[model samples]
Target: MREISLDRLRTLVAIADHGSFAEAARVLNLAPPTVSLHIADLEERVGGLLLSRTRGRVQPSAIGETLIERARRLLADAEQALEDVERQVQGLAGRVRLGASTGVIAQLIPQALETLSQEHAGIDVQVAVLTSQQTLQKLADGSLDIGVIALPQSPVKGLKIKPWRRDPVMAFLPARWACPDIISPAWLAAQPLILNDNSTRLSRQVGEWFATEGPQPTPRIQLNYNDAIKSLVAAGYGATVLPHEASTPAPESRIVMRPLQPSLWRELGIAHRAGEVERSTRHVLEVLWELEAL
Candidate 1:
């Protein structure tokens, strides 16, 4: 069977509304004979006569009414499909997949998403909390559209990295502890430590900092989440080191934030596929960059 034409369906609906072939042709801007031809073709294909003339007025047969109702719904769906595609083409609507560390997601993504919601309501940024290594790997594999990752990374093939922000890595100590003006590695190492898991770049960076001036300390416990590490510190269980963004909430009363004596910093970078990103992803990237604009 030949595929049904949407144009013929449209013509049928117009004729049903106006109750005259002449008026449908006028609204559709077609010759009256073309309107007749459309119905004749539809009727032949469906194997049914579809219209009746009574008292010099046109009305639909039982089959015509059923076809017209379905035709109206089909026409509405097709119009919506076209509009949806057009919105995506205009970068007004689409979905973008993004990956970042739990800390970054907590500190940064919420504000970015809020701003994006205001500016591009049709764009959605799906976030995954992943380690820096995992974020980079997914970006390379095309599983993710963007990544917020730790810096000093070895270059990966087919990925572009740009500095996003640098934040102070502060020691979050139990307020009960007798702490100095600045926290040195020796001072921090001597205390119980709650550090990020060994799998993380943060763990490696903190290790190198301790090795510089004193014995490298082993953490009492290691966990991936920054908030969990802070909770340990707040409970006076152990001291921890984590990046402190201005937007991050101030330490709780039980926790005291102290700068590292050597001034350690956590640098972050934005990463994406090297070239030809989709416009929807690009729109999301613009909002992400606006978070710090660096």
Candidate 2:
């Protein structure tokens, strides 16, 4: 059997991702002809055409799609292997890829990272803001070393989960609105509401909260970013429900945050692949756990 080259596999992936040979060449810093040659070499070795070009757009063929999926896993594993070897040889000096939701990234990860940096300057940290579902997918595929995600995540094989923190969901209203110190779900639902969209788990949870109280007013607007929702709320457009961590007031803000009467909370937790862990990854996790303790 003929061996497939990693370089060729990479070229195939770049072309599939970027949608054109020229675009992939630009991203990979290879000549257009060189990119073409790599694909040609791969197709010959695999005995099948890898890509189909149509009307200036390039797409992966059926065989190409299969190869590309496997290639991504291969590349991620190769990169992790290199990082693991480096950590073994040089102590705690390598990259740790961490994934989390926007709220955690905004409120928690930075503080934890600051402490990690002070203690282990040699370790490099990379953070990606992703939904809990996205974070779990990446962790399963070995693209992420650790993920901080909302709790109640569906069981995923090969993942070890642990609690991180819990944040209360608060109602954010215009400061001028006459509201009690503790707001009720019915009151919040009656008011013009700006809500997290259905794309997020928080939105579903919020929807369920409202459902338990019976039929409620529809949201005036739906958005994914907490800051954007806050901006609209500050303008008196509508109220919103957000994690307390993301309810911080800006200097020029006119938003008032209040806890719910029933007190809903979002639970957060960390997940990593089950079994033996890398030293650098474990060190980063220790730092995060310590920060949580404080």
Candidate 3:
């Protein structure tokens, strides 16, 4: 601020453009005395004359002309910076960082982003594929604005978690199998399964569902990727259980998506910082809620 304050710079530019200190004062809504003080302060700081009187009118001195040109650019940039911030505050423009699992990111998030693009074209959404634990950690650290995480999550400080979707954990079986209208934990336990890795919450939920029926079933192969699991099921390698997001397309040929009997659910929650959320993030949260399953 000591080098050259924006206020004094603005005063110099105004006086030079109007060619009259009184006229500049009137236009700037500053008193004539305040305008005169601003010019004196600027000249003292610059160590030179900034104004000259020629032919009974005021004009910029040689040094003043150079300073004024640079000042105009600075003022324009400052004004534009303010405008950009204002747009963000109003939720008309901003970049929102969102974190979600690979499954949700592949299937559901794109729908929300597509609507966001059409509605708030200036607002950009940056998505990251992360596990629920990773998502919660990112939200706590302020590196992320939103997180679509699996439910039954442990509480984290400085974070707000809300239930977003409760999708039925459907059994994706090979079409060649003698598939029933609704799959049962007992029947699925007997079949070759391509289940999620044991580390995931979905795997735990699926295990618990089968544990209730009888002994927990083992998987032929455990994977973390839903698309890969479905692809294997399509190849008749094994059956897999996955959450069916609302409005998603049907499964590929040779793969049958059937709801599990006993109605197991894969619940998801949205997480964000607990306080003072940015307007752009709030707008994105609203758009995400629009995708919630009934």
- Model 1, 62-112: lDDT tens per residue? 999999999999999999999988887888998889999999988889988
Model 2, C-alpha of 216: deviation from truth (Å): 4.6
Worst 10 residues of 2 by lDDT: 244-253
At residue 99, candidate 2 shows an lDDT of 96
The runs of at least 3 residues in candidate 2 whose Cα sits more than 4 Å from the true structure, single-residue gaps closed, are 1-91, 246-253
Give all TM-scores, in the order shown. Answer: 0.86, 0.67, 0.87
1 versus 2: better lDDT goes to: 1
lDDT, candidate 2, at 243: 85
lDDT of 1 at 113: 90
- Cand. 2 Cα-lDDT: 0.85
lDDT by residue (tens digit), candidate 2, 1-294: 879888888899999988999999999999999999999999898899899988889999999999999999999999999987876556468788999877678768788788888878888889998989999999999999999988887789999999977778888899988988998877788899999888788988888888777775689988777778888989999999888754334323588888887878888889999998887888889988875543
Stretches of candidate 1 above 4 Å error?
A: 31-34, 154-158, 214-216, 274-280
Q: Is candidate 1 or candidate 2 better by TM-score?
A: 1
Consecutive 10-residue window with the lowest summed lDDT within model 3 = 285-294
Ranking of all candidate structures by their TM-score, best first:
3, 1, 2
Error of 3 at 42 (Å): 2.5
How many angstroms is residue 67 displaced in model 2 relative to the true structure, after the best TM-score fit?
39
The Cα RMSD of model 1 versus the native structure comes to 2.7
